[model samples]
Target: MATETFLASFGLVGLRLIERHGIDPAHFARELGIPSTALPDARTRLPSALLDSAFEKAARCIPDPAFALGAAECWHPSHLGTLGYAWLSSGSLRTALKRMARYTKTLGQRMSSRCVETPEGLQFIYDHGRGDTLTGWVMADFGLSLIVSLCRTNDGTDLAPALVTLRRPTPATIRPYEDFFGGPVRFGETHDGLLLSWQVADRPLPTSNRELATTCDAILASELATLQNDDLESRCRAHLLHELTSGEPSDTRLAESLGLSTRTLQRKLAALGLSYRGLLEKTRYELALRYLDDPKKSVTEITFLLGFSEQSAFTRAFKRWNGKAPSDYRQSPGS
Candidate 1:
């Protein structure tokens, strides 16, 4: 059974905000039974219950109801470990957000988030998957505001979500949220999320760095694999997902990225009844289906995205994976 928890680095961010408002950081940590030493290590794990208590306590001691939103300003690229850097270097807001959705579980065990395409734009929804409490409310505020902040940081356009939705009832004052998000906010809704217009979501950011983003993404996948129980196969698949956009990764390249020799990597896979080619094929097949779902991408674009040398090769593989061609599969009834 996985226990709910948050990365200690997040706790550190919250504590710093508490201290900025005149609370003693040491005292806060001590009250929550957190070791002073643990606060300095980004890799440390903090119990979600402790964080919940800390937020509840902060809500009581702090005069402002929106104090947790201060975390939006406090975040640094280091705060989220590798994911933060990966986000900073992402090609676009859409890519960064997808990275967040994929790896948020590494930040908090209970952080369940997704990005859905809607006619209006991309909707990023985050549900902590816990009962309503002061902690949940605080986290919701922090989570939403922090996303906006990150977008502004990388985009340099002060980009605001098209709209904001919340499960919580309307607060005593909506000014703070509206002011923080720089747009209209809807409360008492069925979900908690932000809607980003496609224009801003897909726009190329000035901070885009394909090389660095790819590097950080690889590390994040490896870290996620560790958090998910050190599964080498999972690690391989995750790494491949990030690498596919660049090109089909050779076994030597993949093994070197994972800090293993090619022979060792193959030996380990064989022991588990797996093969490098089989995993690569599976990865490409899975990604092909996802890309095909998006009509914006042409078959040629998807061919390169899947690291295939030509459209013919991809079509052949698609035929093998499914009984029909990619176009046929996409147009078939239900598809």
Candidate 2:
């Protein structure tokens, strides 16, 4: 239930970009209010806010907004160390994605990957339910990098995708999308998804390091198990409720406010058999019912309070959940 830290995975990528761009990584880290020495360990789980700010700065410093994505293309197996190397050694792109989805907590537990087969190709959807600008960008860059890495590991550049889709509309950083994708790139989509040919997914990777894969899996499983048993579930729920009302909630700030490690908080929620999404829905549902019963609260106020994108969506969801329209439920009498 800890607020999803979707951008945490990009800590290393951001640091690498700083170094590649002739900027002092340490200086950049210091500017972000983190220890300069932490750059090497940036791959480890981190507070979502710090990671977001770090990547945002990197995007600004680099000549191209897609610098991180491009850099990830040439990232050596050794650069990612055990985790990255293990993924590279997987049998196929599908297996690698499954590995990443399972151990994503090591990088960013807040986001999850879903793989689907389409007639066009294999689509890997990177779904991030929370976080801010930096977090969002990191997810985009990382997804691209992972694909690039998979291609390299297979020793086939032809396996690259025909298009990459992002949820964020074209912004000043849009140039990077064209440069990194080297193909059609679409913006302003409903969600973040990558489009690759099924043929590439069918190709086998050259290296399959079973020992490395096992070790990485074990490490990730341990972390996940720990997170699943912690008390951070309730705390995350409270944070979600606050965010729903405020529009902007910082996962790092929430963790600090609760005086708990972000990883620990995430682990606790997993142990509770719940997720941030689950808690958010529960919170919204309870609030909707409460407001529906209060004749003094207008539908617009209720919609705004519940952080709904529009009144219609809220109305539809309420009907689905309660088997009655909001107005009808409010008008029902029990006398």
Candidate 3:
């Protein structure tokens, strides 16, 4: 499937949110030739064009001008699949955001985003890849609001940004945007994203779980690697290099991302003379040793980078691999 488009369930969930406002979502879906999925599974992807139509209809149906902001308020992680879990388990807002930019295909596939570190703060550049600004504000608003929500959830604060920008035309007054975002918002701007402070992005999350995050990253990476029919091991390893920080992914999740069932993935791995767990361990070890070689990064940091739950856990595993702690190995000039 093409990258950046949302899953079927995301479309379905948007309908439900519309319905909550007493708008018949099915009518709009049917009117636009957007098929409504009976199931809530986030597997099928519809083009961004269809979603843009949905947003337009949703705006028409709702009398409220801030419907997009409200739609994002209704969003839950389930609407995003493993991307939600990965965001939830991120070590910090900055790390989570980098992961989001890296795996945008699995989440908001049509929304282009980047986190740029500036002297003042982090400026997140975001834009709807295929929609005109006239009706694109809904998608843009929903995306920006969701990013704000994710940041708040990670740092557990009011988490206001330094500045916010939108691609939509200027409203009658800026009060609604400011009131909603808790910051000054610029309409008719060049971009559609937030400018946040370094203090907010650098703050660590209480729910940080390196191992679990690595698993999520594995799914995230595989979702973006759908162009070729390369060897499963090579493809898997290549994806692993990008995703291992999210944590070890489940067999079913990884299999689905690879466009196969668990049995099929296992069979292919077996054909290649490999098992999923074995490959995962080997990848982790390789990453661990590589990270350990750099004395500047503490083992605590390396532990999270390798997706270990904690430093002590990484230490125990490193000892098993090299018969010495990571600190000892880092100190040793060589035997």
lDDT of each: 0.81, 0.62, 0.73
Better of 1 and 3 by lDDT: 1
Q: Count the backbone clashes (under 3 Å) in each candidate.
A: 0, 6, 11
lDDT ranking from best candidate downward: 1, 3, 2
* lDDT for each residue of candidate 3 in 259-317, tens digit (9 for 90 to 100): 89999999989997899888877777756754664556788888888877788988998
Sequence-dependent TM-score of model 1: 0.72
Over 19-126, each residue of candidate 1 has an lDDT whose tens digit, in order, gives 889999888889889868243566778777787788789989998887877888788877788788878887778878887987887788778788998899989999
TM-score of each: 0.72, 0.59, 0.67
Q: Is candidate 2 or candidate 3 better by lDDT?
A: 3
Cand. 2 Cα-lDDT: 0.62
Candidates arranged by TM-score, highest first: 1, 3, 2
Deviating ranges (above 4 Å) for candidate 1: 37-39, 230-335
Task: Measure candidate 1: CA RMSD.
Answer: 8.9
Alpha carbon RMSD to native, model 3: 10.7
The most accurate candidate by TM-score is 1
- lDDT tens digits, residue span 7-52, model 2: 2334555566668768887787788876644435423455666655
